[model samples]
Target: MFGDIMGMMGKLKETQQKIEETKKRLDFVLIDEQSSDGLLKVTLTANRTVKSIEIDDSLLDDKEQLEDYLVLVINKAIQKASDVNEAELGAVAKDGMPNIPGMDLFK
Candidate 1:
């Protein structure tokens, strides 16, 4: 019985290490989103860090509209990044804790 417990513990530790490694890789996962008119674009990482913002010169004449579009595009980028991050983390969790009841909730 003790040997079985120790083996399980080892497996748990290994799974935890894998989870950490996966999280590190998530830092490099980028999500890009752009406005419908292609006036604005945003790049964000799965870790919710904004990498870059791009705006077309055509929007320069309309400050108010430009600000609105910027906000819209930024939110869209963040949402996309968040969705990808959740999916990746869910995959990790499913791998680490297989066969548990309600585990599909992670998906």
Candidate 2:
């Protein structure tokens, strides 16, 4: 019984170490998400950095349309960033504790 407990403990510790290493690795990756329309683009790094943004040239031809599309694009980018963040966090949470309830894991 004691041996089994020790084995489990060691396993848990190793798993934790792996999780930490994965988090560090995530820092180097950029999880990009965007909309089907070229107006909305988001490039978010795993470290939570916003890298760059691009807007469509045609939208600039119309003032009101440009403003509307700009707002739409920003919102979409933010939503996409949130989704990527949540998914990554969920993966990490499941890797460690898959049984925890109310673990929105991202929230």
Candidate 3:
């Protein structure tokens, strides 16, 4: 009984370590997004940190249009980053989880 608990605790600690490592790794995982017309582009990490933004000179002429493009493209990039972050962390968590009777946390 206690042995099982101790083993589970150890597994949980290892999982936490792996989660931290995965988060660090995600900083290098880049996600790119752009506008449909190709006037704006964004690059970000899976950790949701923006790395770069490229805008065509034509977009600089219109404030509202540029704002719209930025909002759309950045939002798309954030969503993609979020997906990657979740998947990576989820896989690590799921893989490290200890199987407990009737818990079924991953399901």
TM-score of each: 0.81, 0.52, 0.98
Put down candidate 2 lDDT per residue, 38-84, tens digits, no spaces.
66566666656677766677756789976776566556656665676
Per-model lDDT: 0.83, 0.63, 0.97
Off by over 4 Å in 1: 98-107
Model 2 spans > 4 angstroms off: 56-107
TM-score, ranked from best to worst: 3, 1, 2
**Mind giving the per-residue lDDT tens digits that candidate 3 earns over 9-56?**
999999999999999999999999999999999999999999999999
Off by over 4 Å in 3: none
Could you tell me the lDDT of residue 82 within candidate 3?
99
- TM-score of candidate 3 relative to the true fold: 0.98
Candidate 2 local lDDT, residue 95: 68
- Report the C-alpha displacement of residue 79, candidate 2, in angstroms: 6.5
Cα shift from native, residue 53, model 1 (Å): 0.7
What TM-score does structure 1 among the candidates reach? 0.81
Q: Candidates 2 and 3: which is better by lDDT?
A: 3
Worst 10 residues of 2 by lDDT: 98-107
**Best of the candidates, lDDT:** 3
